[model samples]
Target: MSGHGVALRVVACGKTFADGTRALAPVTLDVGRGETAVLLGPSGCGKTTLLRIIAGLETPDPGGRVLFGDSDVTGVPIERRNVGMVFQSYALFPNMNVADNIGYGLKVRGVGEAERKARVAALVALTGIEGLERRRIDQLSGGQRQRVALARAVAVQPSVLLLDEPLTALDAALRERLRGELNRLLRTLGITTIYVTHDQAEAMALGDRIVVMREGAIAQIGTPRAVYFAPENRFVAEFVGAANLIEAACNGATLALPGGTLPVADGALHGPATAMIRPEAIKIVPAENASLIGLVDSVSFLGDRQRVLISAAATKVITADVPNAIALAAGDRVGLSVEPAAIRLLPGDTT
Candidate 1:
């Protein structure tokens, strides 16, 4: 909290290995001051590469630049970048206790004992590791280790914070719990944070804006709601959330599907088109009043909702999420209705 977060700019940044392997295409992005931007994609999508470039751990290609506010840090090394990094492994020293680990960075910068102690104590309380000051890194639980790593990273009051899948090592429940806690901590700290994660849920929860990356290139960048509801491309639509890509022929206002006709939000000129609908958007209705009818292929009972897969509604199997109270089973004939606004027309052919 002592250091002010600066706006970060990555200008036409690209990366290529020595063997001529291009890990990332040139990407230009701006992260506003105290903004939390998440670089999200699948494995090998170069999200980590981009983060490393921003951290000054990996240099960008010629003509690419990384800037912190007005300062060009492209040529700066990680040690001189005034940034905090938390890795998937936490990377705490096995020999160091919690207090020592949190105060290590300040000590390295030649801060006196009294100041280090005060800083360490404050961070310990901030990260909720109050009673673990003397606990060794190896003696803590995975969650505790994660908290310690975070405290250590922020203790130096870095201008920027970079986290690379910091919660990937935890159990599912713990990961979910820590995500909320982390979100709160980040907002409280008001640091310019760039987080990298392959998990879309994590990205949605933490990112003020999500940068969706594909094999070395950015597919889309938008707020979680924007990307989830109006994906710019097929990859983003399918990756950010569960989307049902339906292939149908568009005739102005309605799409002619194999099962029946569905209305579109727009009634403009169109031919064959690919449309996307979220599972929760599809509502199950009485077959007599519905235009689309299908036989249920499978029903998965999730705690709060039921994932119902219906066939014959479209060219492909259409999945829907209905309230758990609604009884549904395989082989049952069901009617499906969706609001026209919920259907998004995506670019590209119906293939």
Candidate 2:
């Protein structure tokens, strides 16, 4: 489908409700043409609010501005903004068949009946729902319904697509399958898209760039690799992935952990920092090396890897992912060593 190409620019965007609750604060973001940007954060962190502002469903505060290409769209209404939205509920019309549902927007725009039918047919084929075009909403499975909703959203050939936790209702296996399909479809369509989700895994898997939002503000924005491996702060590190944060005190050149003294990277010897390490970054060894002695508290198998929970200090449990072949039961003593370069230091105030 062909339509007007557009890029989005959100400049100093802020959102505050009449009840005096500030949903988002002074946020600025730019989505390049045909790029997919994912807004990821916990609930009530303003990711959804920011998305609404972009969709023109929620107006930004006076100082903020939303631009679609060169036109300022902050004051535009939702329908006027050539954007399509997919909600968590899939929001299908129970009374309409898949073809009618997909063609509704085009019909409303006064397009010829023949053109609408042709467009809907192409969308049904694109979404792999040709036979199901006549099916009612209640007759479709969750995944099928989701595809219909997506097809409907794209039927209008929107310049920007906004999705709010669209796959959160699906089961784990189905969610994984559809996530891959959605990523491929979005890339093929090449529409500038903004997706909002609380699932960090989904964000990491789908986003060309992940924007990490904190309470009412942006914490960091980067590619999935940079956001996961080089988080700017402790909140981003812990929120994006499972980070084993060890308490450490910096002393010029080295960091003192409860287990042992870990050498700090050059110019990173800041005072009172937490050493962040991924569970997979910690290796299990039989001999005592530069390691921490811990007693295994619990072990659980997760298909390919075993999650070993070890206790190094009182009430402090460290998680490590060991290969399933390395059998170890609870109460077994082990040594855990991490690569020096894998350590990341964040301020102690990070929570």
Candidate 3:
């Protein structure tokens, strides 16, 4: 709560190992004051490398500079950077109780007993770990342990908070619950947080902007709504969620699918193109009134909605989510309709 989250800048930053393997290509990005920016991608995508560079745990290649606001901190060490880091593992000290663990950073910095106790108490309350201050690390559950770890990290009020898959170790239900809690906490603390994860849901939930990476380079950077609704590339569309990719030729009016033609918007010139439709975008209507018809390969009831997998809607199979009370089933004939604006045309032909 007392932290000052500054703007972080990475200019021409890149990483390479001693063995001459380039871990990351040169890149530049900015994390604005009090903003949460997520580095999202698969393993070995250089997300962690960039995070370490920002945290001062890993040195960038020459000519790369990491700046905390106006001051260049490229030569600084991790301890001197004033950063709070939380990892997938709850890296709390086993011998220390919760109070001592939370106050360890203050102790290391030689803060007086009175000040350390006050700060620890504030953090303990902030992280909802008040009643467990006297408990040992072994006495807490996975969620509680993570809470303590986060509290310990924030107890020092670091300038930037770096979290690397902090909630991944917990079970599914706990992970989800903690994600919402963490999002609220980060916003409440007003900390400039940089979270790294391969989970799209986590990125969507927490990030003010997501930096999508691939093969040691950045693929795209945008807000959750921008990335989800208007993906820049085919990889982004497919990776973020289930996308119904329809490959067809455009004649400036409509796209010709195997089943039928769907209306198209402008800017999709005469050439080979791919259209991406999200599962929720495609509507299931009566066969005669629909734009295209397909046989329902499978229908799965998912409480509020039903997931219908189309065996053949076009050249590719399409997955659609419709209302649960549609009375649809596998082996049933169904019609699919989609809004023209919802159909996003991707450039080039990877068909």
My TM-score estimates for the predictions, one after another, are 0.98, 0.94, 0.97
Q: Return whichever of 1 and 3 wins on TM-score.
A: 1
Please give the CA lDDT of all the candidate structures.
0.93, 0.86, 0.90
Could you give candidate 2's per-residue lDDT for residues 15-75 as a string of tens digits? 9899999999889999988888999999999999999999999989988999999999888
For model 1, how does the per-residue alpha-carbon lDDT over 172-254 read when each residue is reduced to its tens digit?
A: 99999999999999999999999999999999999999999999999999999999999988899999989999878898899
In order of listing, the candidates' clash counts read 0, 0, 0
Which sections of candidate 2 miss by over 4 Å?
2-5, 313-315
Worst lDDT window (10 residues) for model 1? Answer: 342-351
Q: By summed lDDT, which 10 consecutive residues of candidate 2 come out lowest?
A: 259-268
Task: Please give the ranking of all candidate structures by lDDT, highest first, separated by commas.
Answer: 1, 3, 2
Once fitted onto the true fold, the runs of candidate 3 whose alpha carbons sit more than 4 angstroms away are 349-351
C-alpha lDDT of candidate 1 relative to the true structure: 0.93
C-alpha RMSD between model 2 and the true structure: 1.9
Candidates 1 and 2 compared: the better one by TM-score is: 1
